[model samples]
Target: MTSPSQEEDDVEEWRVLYQETFGYRRPLFHPEHAVFQFQPDPKFPGHQRNNNRERREENDVDEEEDVEEWNPWKESYEQLSRGVHVMNSFEQFVGAADIQCFDHIDEALKFLDENPEGHHEKLIFLHEGTHNVNHTIRIASDVQIIGASSSEDIAASVILTGRHATILEIQEGARSPYLGWITVKYEVDTEHEAEMALIMEVDAPPPPEPNSSGAVADNDDDDDLEKVNEIESDQTTNCAMVVTGRGVEPIIESCHFQSGNADHHTVVVKDHAAPKIKNSKFIGGSGGGIIITHQAAGYYDTCEFAQNLRSGIRVQFQANPYFYKCAVHHQGEVGVFILDDGLGHFQNCDIFSNAKFGVELTSPNANPTITECEIHHGELGGICVHEEATGQFLKNRVHNNAFLAVWICGGANPILRQNEIFDGKHGGILVHRYGKGLIEDNEIYGNVLAGIFVETGAQPWIRNNHIHSGKQAGVYFYDNGSGILEGNEINGNTLTGVQIRTGANPRILKNRIWNNDNGVLIHEGGQGCLEENTVFDNTTTNVFIQTEATPTVRKNKIFGSRETGILITDGGKGTIEDNEIFDNGQAGVMILSEATPIIQLNRVHGNRSAGIEVSSKGECVVRENRVFRNRFGGIMIASGSNVADSSLNQVYDNLDRVSKAIDRGHCLFSVSGKEFYPMHNFYRCITCNSSDRNGICQSCIKVCHKGHTVMFLRCDRFYCDCGADHLERSCCLRQS
Candidate 1:
């Protein structure tokens, strides 16, 4: 038995011997573990090494302790078992189609123009493997340049980092001052070659020396300003005029773009050109990451933009970029920035920790559709829909933002609906003055401030939402916004569940507001309608009319509140009627200020406080009610509220008019009352009555405190079965 390493050495010798029989250009030549493509050898004398025919019954002998390492008997068995196929390196790899490699970037760019391989099918690689770019390369129509990977597996082997622009902005300017002062030619005249003269008359111009002021004195101050204005002509312009302009379409995909690491941009398209990009990752340099100008619709999808000094993607001069499914993070200043009426539609992108907003579509008509994206844990809001820009946001989950979920200052109509927003310090949606927008059906919960914050003068129609568990009310209407608030279930919030303040006459109707501190609180001169709502079980008052707002509170089931059911504090008034207010801990109605209320026809009962309590000195009428069975008096007129000899207020308690016996236990009752509205006045009859506990038929007299009584046929008190009673005429009763 020989060693395994020695056995491998024998195999390499046999492979080298067989490769000399065939002629082939080699690839990855190593003696021991060489590719069989280069070393196509099979015929060897050591291939016929026969196996050992020793005695069976475990006849094995090895004096060496490391038997696994010293034995080489099984080595040749593997080579004989699995035959190897020699790969032809020429046929294995084609001559690298779709890539025009050049020794220099200039040569590669020369090929980009003369080269016919554009968007149809072609890719370029700047394979100079050096960090030098004295001449820039302008990307022509529909051409892509991708860098080469070092290894086949692409682990880590690109040592050469060429500092060059993957796509450079070909700047073109006016030839002379006459072109700037043109009164006739409006559009860029690219056809007629105007022989425009050079304005600069520089003869043997000196090299522009830096660190010694700019072509003049060091702060000549007023003189420098005059000199700057003198050279402000087209002579100092650095632009090549478009001799024959072409509508450019190019995509700089999967290339390492470097620009001196200064505050410069990577891909600069200053002209009116739109580039479509996909599946590209960019490691940016000092310049702006991507700059679009004029009317360029730069469409980018599934791109990763990271580690840039300036904005991730910037658009200016009415040029915007449409982005979809792009990851933009770890940028220097702002991410996905658009200024000066530039617009873009951003969809399904992860934008977090950006210094500014995720996507900024500023100015007017710069609207965008931002939908179906999870924008969470961002430094600012998930999206800032402001600056006269409108947006349509749907099905987005914006959570854990430092600011509001969405900041909307839309000057026009913006629609933001069906978004679940939470975990922010501010409101979920903030609408400011020039903001006209529709907020509907957004699950805004567990935030610090109001859910939908609309300021004064914003009449946005808010409808159909589930807002719960916010720090303030669900929808805070302020700043004179008279929107319609309907069909919203606002529950379990801390403050007024839905506050319509700031003189906003919001139609607060058909909203199920419950379990908050106060169900619906209105203040500061908003005269609106609050009708057809089941406002119930709030901790504080159901509806608080504060600060001169007189909302019409009618046909609302205001019940089970801890404080007054309808607390009309301050100076607010409404016609209160037909509300089934029952079983609350406080009064069914509380009227404060100088509020003269037409209180009529409300079923106010079983409240601990008075049914209709007045707290102000005013002329009011409380008329016509079966208001009874309250813990305190039915109607309490407080100290400062009762007018001078109030005659219009009617109160009723235990009225008898030939009525039948009361259902509970009243002993004596008249049965011949035809026109009766529950004409029986019922009581327990404790002193002269007796009946079974939990029995359906209540006694017609007052029951005793611990014992009942018996009223006989002649008004005598017999000892009833349940208690002890007195004797008036002739009947007997027992105490039981």
Candidate 2:
């Protein structure tokens, strides 16, 4: 509302204040500090009048200046300049000076070249704007480069693009090139098909040259010039970040790396470089998230690696990487792949939902330790250790995998202890192809296959585990596999608790096996010892030995089986001794189909059928067994079978003491060493001292011995007085 002349005078006063306070040749304004006011100077009245006339004449040249508004509150020039100076001082102290701000990538390259020796305390700050670095910018030793606040801010402020070229290179002899608070993204439509955004090359310092006196000359002037030229020539590769160095320990913190190329990794640590990365994220790369190779080692803390085309982390060639509390998921291949002697240690990490195995290790000596981690929802197994890889898998929860929770093959020996491996489509742990290790103190259940499966000479020490509720056997050993299963609780399985077949020889000891279809099955030439095990409450035979399997089952308490306690059939031969076999629906020991089992010193009682039944050409030596309280006879030898020696067995309290089949149709009686055709055969009573000599025939045995209970004997010599007097005398009363 002021007059035109007064308004012109007020604008002139502000212009003089700004020029005197800032001492700038050109006018400058900041949008953020627009509310700050200016005061006119008092000492330069004639000079300010001359400047007012010059500014009024220049305002006519720019029409936009006429519509510009000024601040309402008036601040003195001293106050305004002091606030700006304080802020600028702090910014400059933190390495945010005007010389550090570079609008073009060439300016940054020139600055790096000028500071060849590298100021240790200096930090290069890329200004808040897009910077298309057409070539690589090599950083010197002990130099630090810090970008804007965050990855998103850097993305909006600095956009780096290169065509088949690396964006930044931390050159050789550069020590501790620390990169923080930045985002390095690779962008190229089609012309710039580069695969890298930054590369750190670490090389050893040049050796001193020999002078004419055969002594070492410390001449490094030409070497420095040659190194600069070599760095300038190495700007034409393709990667997101490549660390190629020997004995280099790079520190990267709070950085984000993403790539659009399908064959580019977000970060690659190669050639013995050991990098420590903290609180970083690698996302949306088509090649892989992070790769460590050529004996490189990496330590990552609280990082996230996701949405990669290949494995989230791929390590090979003796590279060792340690991941702490990181998340690796949604990968195209396995979450972490370690091969060719690569070693990895993953602790307290969440690895899930990958296309392949959660962690796959292969090749010789590729050892990795996965402890206290949750690995689940993998397309393949949770962890696949194959091809001579050995490590420790301790305290991990491996579940909900499509295949086995842990698949071991090709002689890989890994110690799996105190792990909860359950709810998988296949077995909980599978060992094949000569794989051997110690599986101890694990809870393995709810798997589609057996809880632990060992095949093809895989000899693992499976002990102290609780394996139950599996769709198949709790522990399955087949294909010539030999192992020791001790102190395990195997129960509630749909099939046999422990099955050994196909020539598997496993020493199963001290395991509580119950509530399964068959407690333990040794079949198909499987030979082992089932000792000190408590096997009970099975649906079928507690211990089934068949198909030429010779398992020495001793000192086992086997009871509560729906069928026979021990069924040895199909030429299976072993020693069954010192076992308590009772409370079965059928016989305690049933040997059929030519099976030859030596049964000794076993308490065989409380069964529905005979305590020991040998039939169908089965030959067994039943000796020193206490056979009693059975519904059928104590020992029943069927028609075609024979017990070679059934001695010292206390057979009592059964329906009959001992029942044996006798072919009476071929009986020929001989009297006084003369063979004669007799009408029938008579038998003697051993227990009763019978005065009545009632001779009994095979057909009418009950009528012949009305009040005398007798045992019909198959005597090939005589048809004499068969009474209690002659029972203890001889086999035949023949007067020769």
Candidate 3:
């Protein structure tokens, strides 16, 4: 253990490290400007510490075309406030290159107008300035009005006063000069207190639990390694930072851009060159937080855009912005808006909500690649695709939205794969108006409507989706829609599990349909093939083949419903073959007056009512069927029913078997017939406590963890322990 004095020295060394590594410049508001140690060396590539040059180089990987010019959270520790001291040696705020006052937006415009040659290699630093850029201010052509300092003695941040539009109505010598200050003292205090709270937010770390292998470790090698190799991975900061205006290709990295001008945007680009902004934060503004517009592609990596009023990041007008490991959360409106003329490719972004859509795509005919995003809790849908927008959504967690998980309108086709869409109040994916796509391998559950609904000529292939617990059908094809619904596990939907209505002809194959109100409901003109599907345990019937829809149902297990297994009526002529239909509330197969389904080689048994009840047209070849154990007669062929050719069908128990001998047995299991063995793991306790339990959170799961705590992850059943609080599995167990 280090002594108090030694601890103090350690603290000093840490302060130095902060200064050297992240440029925690004394009281600097934005942490990004601090030079980062990516790997290997602190200043391995260059000496300036700022990543502007390196970022520019990275941006050059994709050659971009430029049409116009572009302009481009401190936690409190009151003692370690993130604002840097005013540079005394340099003029406090009065260099021709530096600014101490704004007074109006024109002053900034004037500065830019004078720097028409471009402020390259010159910084228009704003320190202790009462600059009120209430409106837009163009930058140094390629200039940086950076409020980021370079000092480590303190949490050096940049602060510029925004008293824009405040009228001076004070009486200096009339006994009322200081009265105004006193009158507004409490309000001023409240503002200061809020600022203090914002500053005091410390970047806490996450807790630790079981290892990746789900095993417990005795030592905290991971935690120690993390600390020893800790860099400023967190990029959140105090203010809204916006850099806009002209330049060929302006580059921005590691910036904290806060909005205080009472305008709507935090950091924005109206019309400018391509920008490469990585490792930044934009927080707490009323307007659209980060707006990237004007036809230039933007690249943002590892940035956090949180606590804003409008959309987190608005990409508009032919702009292509690619985001990697970015977070957009807690906004008033949309999380990320891909408006007309622009598309966004988002990778590994966490987008929750404060108000509206988590991700909104408005442009028609632009399908962006969205990979591995955790999108949840939107006021509207997790993702709203409108007007011919097309994209591939892969490896995403889309759940808990107020509206549909994915709402596609006006002919948008989004190929969805490997997504978990669950627990939403509305439908899962609604494809309307000629949208053509596939919904495959998605775990879609707990929704109100059909998991996948296609309407108005939409031909979507719905496959491999585990859809359950919805209020309506799991997959509904309606109104001229045609597709293939195959290989899906659809169960527990309140209504029909797969509803094909309104002329929709969907080939339903190899689907596991169970525990639904109706397994498969077919309405008018919905004629398709139901092949090799395991449809069972529905409340009403396994299949409700309605008028004029004669689907060829072959080789299916249709049973265990409250009513008849297969209900056919109104001239429905379905071909049913080799189906195992049993244990239904009514008959195994119910045929109405006009129904004439051809059934052959089916195991129809154990129905409470009848095995094959026909009124008018059950003229099926009842041959080779195993009909037995029904409460009533197996063949209840009543008036006008033509049940002919009932030969070779083995009937028993309920006196329904007409042909051969039958045997009964229970408890059937399938075997893999492959050789396998079990493995064993052993362990011993060292420092045994009074109670017998796992010693460490690694073993138990009750302790704090590590990292900048960018997200809150609840630990598993085991407690959490990591970071400063690691456990000693037992004080005795030793491999040494």
Residues 1-736 of candidate 2 have per-residue lDDT tens digits of 3445675677566655554433322332212221211233333345544654566577664433444333221233222232211112223233213223445545554566576565412334443444555665655454545443223444344344454455665545655766654567665447322211222233435567788999996655542133432453222135566776775666776667766656656677877777778878887786788888878887899999999898899888888889999999989998989888888899999999999999998888888889999999999889998888887899999999998899888988889999999999988999889988899999999999999998899889999999999999999999988889999999999998999988888899999999999999999898889999999989988999999998899999999888789999999999999999998877889888999989999999997667888876888899999999976568777655678768678988875311221242211223111221122335655444533354333422333334556776542212344321243433222221
Q: Determine the backbone clash count of candidate 3.
A: 64
Ranking by lDDT: 2, 3, 1
Residue by residue across 217-264, what tens digits does model 1's lDDT show? 354444212332144222111111111112554443333333333434
> How well does candidate 2 match the true structure, expressed as C-alpha RMSD?
16.9
Q: With candidate 1 superimposed using the best TM-score fit, by how many Å does residue 80's alpha carbon deviate from the native?
A: 35
Structural similarity to truth (TM-score) of each candidate: 0.61, 0.68, 0.58
What tens digits encode model 3's per-residue C-alpha lDDT throughout 8-121?
454455445444322333422322332222222233113321343455466663224431211011121222232222232343332222223343434543645565565322
Best by lDDT: 2
Candidate 2 overall lDDT versus native: 0.71
Clashes per candidate (backbone, < 3 Å): 37, 8, 64
Q: Which runs in model 2 stand beyond 4 Å of their true positions? A: 1-99, 105-121, 127-130, 149-161, 171-174, 187-237, 261-264, 629-633, 653-736
Runs with alpha carbons beyond 4 Å of true place in candidate 1? 1-101, 109-123, 141-144, 151-248, 256-264, 269-272, 282-288, 307-310, 315-321, 410-412, 502-504, 524-528, 572-583, 593-609, 616-635, 643-736
Q: Supply candidate 2's per-residue lDDT for 340.
A: 84
Which residue pairs of candidate 2 clash? Answer: 129-157, 195-238, 195-239, 196-238, 196-239, 196-240, 197-239, 197-240
